[model samples]
Target chain A: MMVPATSAAPQSGAHDKVPLLELEHLQMLFPARAAAFGGKRGHVHAVDDVSLALAEGETLGLVGESGCGKTTLARCAVRLLAPTAGKVRFRGADITSLGPRAMRPYRKHMQIVFQDPQGSLNPRKRVRQIIGAALELSAGGSGDDRLRMLLDQVGLNPEHANRFPHEFSGGQRQRIGVARALAVDPQLIVLDEPVSALDVSIQAQVVNLLDDLQDEFGLSYIFVAHDLSVVRHVSDRIAVMYLGKVVELSPAEELYRRPVHPYTLGLLGSIPIPDPVVSRSRPRQLPRGELPSPIDPPAGCRFHTRCPGATDICREVEPPLTLYPGGHEAACHHPLNVSSSDIAGAVRSPAASRSSGSVVPVPPGG
Target chain B: MTLRDTGTGHVPVNESAVGVLDVPAEPYAAGAATYRLALRRLRHNHRAIVFGSLFVLVVVLCLLAPVYARYIAHTGPNVQHITEVLDINGKSVDVVSLTGVPVGPTWHSRFFLGADADGRDLAVRLLYGGRTSLAIGVMATAITIVLATVLGLVAGYYGKWTDGVISRVFDIVWAYPALLLAIALGVSLATGGISIGPVQINSGSILIPTLVIGIVYVPYVARPIRGEVLALREREFVESARALGFSNFRIMASEILPNLTSTLIVFVPLQLAHSIILEAALSFLGAGVQPPAASWGTLLASGAPLFNVAPYLTLAPATMLVITCLGINVFGDGLREALDPRATVRTGY
Candidate 1:
């Protein structure tokens, strides 16, 4: 179900003009294995027709469960993994097809903050060496003042520069990782679950640090996360993905307030709200069945089997992303309204309405 | 910085405690912990300690070879050697000097193992031979490590054509048997007499053999270093270094090479032992150190014929050779185990 355009109010600001990064028709497909004797093979669409854009100083949150192609999308955005079929335009330049030598200059402009901080840093190197390596690689000036300033900026003492990664706490090591990423003075950073491996308390500290750094540097971030709450706070616009396709994309506040897609509404409702009274008062929509294997995703809509708003159309023909009134878009044959009414008449059968108290609206002008 | 604040308006500070009680910052430094862990791992192996001590003793003996020579000289000729005595048939009779011989018909007062076919004091030769063997082993291993490290670092870090060329070269060298090539080089040198000033030496001498042996084993040392470099190149720290704008050379040397120290330490002793053994085998085959220039291999070769009559000659040199190799092998094994991170934790290092 596509979001109705009336509900999505366009923002009035100069910020809408400049996009930091844009991806069009991003598709990464892996060759499928043949049968036991190589009889027949099918392609696995790991990432199919995914598109999103980030504005300067804006954090675009990409949230998906495992195997939803969230990580692959992130890697492709930073040019770590080549996209099989897509146009990755960074500042209006197509970089998807650039060779290694040609991509060197872009490497400085874009950086990635990996999920596993321990695996990311060299175990044998000192903190200063790890942070300073990026500077030395880009042929940046290496004055003592410059190095010290970076260390201080990351909230690490300059004197602790001589220490190796194994000597530091998980939080400190992650800070060092951030410092390394910042060394290149990158305009955009792809943070792949930066705080997923840290303690809850440490996660908050890191998230706050990231917010502060973003403001200070005017950097754009593609924050990939599994946690909805965390993504809501960091992201200006959040995209929810399922089975290699974006099921929903909307502004963070709007998406949380009134999610049009059944899958998205289910996700938000499943999250236990911090306020006990509001959580008990609010309606919760828990999805049934496990996420299907990506190798053989559903024929029509990948989430059709588990979607609460699934219909004959959702089972036979995939719904294209329809723009909602408030800039929200969702791919569902039948979508739920704020009052729990179906946007399509498919859910309005006497048998369907009698089975549940939820009112099913007739299709627009049906 | 102010040492103290005025008590009139500000909070009072402890003046005496400021300078006296200094809580050392960053007490858990990397150096102290790494060393501590290494020492802890090393302490668990009893055999390693014993062999390591023996290695130390051998090194000390080689260092004081001059002092040992003087002591032996003061003790006088202890072995009998057949030298410059005419026989009853009017020929130059071999009057065997029992004194200073390593092994002979009679035990000499000071000769521990007796003499060789040429009547050179075997005890004196053993000490001097050790000096040569140890020196060659160390020098060759050093050169091998240096060459291998540089090539490996370049190949693994740079990739592309650099990696391709270095890897191909290494593969070519690795395809050949190192010992066979070393022998061939030694034979070639022997055919072409090499001279330094007035001292002419055969190509089959220890000098040529050591040089050939060192060069042949360079690939062995290099391949491991290349593997290590490749693994380290992908590490986040290396990427961080790149992001920090570090030069490729700086990253390879400071960040990459330093991490490979444990691997190097383990490989060096094994390489040294192999070189020493190869040098001895070459000498025994008469393709290494020429006659009159004493070596453990030469001693064993001469002693082999007299094994039935006087076994001490062969026994003494063979025993020393075995002990030296064993000691080195044990130490190398200990170092390998100690350097392994998983082993370090289990062994309390």
Candidate 2:
């Protein structure tokens, strides 16, 4: 399955093997309200048609703002929630409709670290019981020796284990959560905004702990986050989602270097640069139009209503994901060409484009 | 914000970013179970300790009533020493004063708390009455809460139709005024006793009042337990339990139930108070505890007419009842404060 690519990264080696996990056409629609008469029932399309894959030991970053269905999609991926329709394949085995009993053995391989650290663990439980529970469940029973080893591995003292979650700081709690997930000896872990709830100073600590653990355990991760800088710091490949659809999928460097989708360019423009000098000189251009309701989405591309380069053709028919240089794919009608005349062509100056960095040669082929 | 204008060199270049920082443990770390922590808190509370000790003392007296009666009093609770022959300070003189009833505390011969209208030692009878009242309260609470907890957990966890059916039943039970419903049930069931397929209960059986009181207070305990369970069902920890492949039973028992210790502990003393009062009410109406049993309610009923004569007869049980209920209530309030984990939660997290 190894497919040689023009990208400088070595992740192309993953192409030869079956992905650790793959989702095909996932859809999750929640019932909003029942119709009064014989009318059709209304639904909130939380997660519409979407597909993705995760290679072994690879981190795929799923980036989107809140209400864009990142959490729901993650839930569907791990079978925490059954998708309205889709195939969730784990190493080429379909597990989408597995019953709770059938899902038990698979749970040891797939674990989720939720967004809120305090809420993820039972406050009534002691830290030892919290982490010890996973150890016991996955391995029948575990001694304090293994427990202490796990605590130390996560940069925590064994003495802290007997304390309750309330006594711990936010970063320490997240470390305990990581210890819990690792106790199960999982293959893939879904990190749902793992640092979004932490203070900025502590967020880096947790993120680094997660990165180090992934290498030590050879674990695959679906790191979902709303922060682009954080995602770029971690992900091998980035998939930008909008209104329950993947608008662009590309290698991390290539996507930032040549963001083919107008939506991606607008998102990049929003990240604040620490150098006040550069920020003062940068032009201010926000994305236009309101997000439509998921219940009654606009025709054709869901992003067309807000896309800066959206044309009437984008409004007439939905465009399939089109291939671009360096294996990048963007679903759009009038895609940006490159850095020279790229990103809305009219508002952006080549000088400002140069300021954004990521200037690279046009990739040879898809 | 870390991403600067290309030349700042502050942020990592995509591939290499965010270095590891190990956070050390606090200087003093202690992990204790909520129960042990609550116990430590209770020990620190002077009011709870004093009142809790008083309440325990009363309960111990009630349990050892027979010991206080046979070995110490030298007279059975049913014995009649009507004229009350007594040797006061080595002088053979009856202790009955101007009232023509056996009276005055002899201290010796064990008429310590004095004698009631029945010519029985009032002290011994008070202990026996306290024992009966304690039994009825505790037994009724045990029956009511066990039923309520099971119903509440099932209804709250499996919401739609199961919740509907159980809640409707709880509603119907809740609609009635507690004492009135208790009286009605007590009279109907205890009038001629009850006989099922293989079991038969006599009208005098203590189960009559216990059953009536237990049935009456079901809604009080069940409604709160159900409400707590409903909230807990939405907690992320509960969902995590399910995610970890714990069965519904494990999730409810191990995850949700342990978190409800404060609620359940708070409920017990209140339920005990209610059960005692309800049993007293039923016994006063002659539909509870029957004739031979000397419950606080029965003794009070018999002594009310004697309010003009032997005042101690009426005053003794009424005063004991008030003290017992008050001690329980005050101690229960302190327990609520002591057991509250939220009060102990460290802030600035």
Candidate with maximal DockQ: 2
Per TM-score, the best of the predicted structures is: 2
Give the TM-score of chain A, superposed on the true chain A, for all candidates in the order listed: 0.85, 0.86
Of candidate 1 chain B, the 10-residue stretch with the lowest lDDT total is B11-20
- Fraction of true inter-chain Cα contacts (below 8 Å) kept per model? 0.16, 0.29
CA lDDT, candidate 2, residue B68: 85
Model 2 complex DockQ against the native: 0.22
Clash number for candidate 1: 56
Rate residue B210 of model 2 by lDDT: 94
Model 2: lDDT to the true structure = 0.76
The residue-by-residue lDDT of candidate 2 on A89-179, one tens digit each, is 9998899999989999888889988888888888778888888778876763588888988888887878777778767777778878888
Which tens-of-lDDT digit does each residue in A36-132 have in candidate 1? 8847777777888787777777788898877889988997887766799877988888999877667778888888887878767776667776666
| Model 2 clashing residue pairs (backbone) | A1-A15, A1-A16, A2-A16, A162-B31, A163-B31
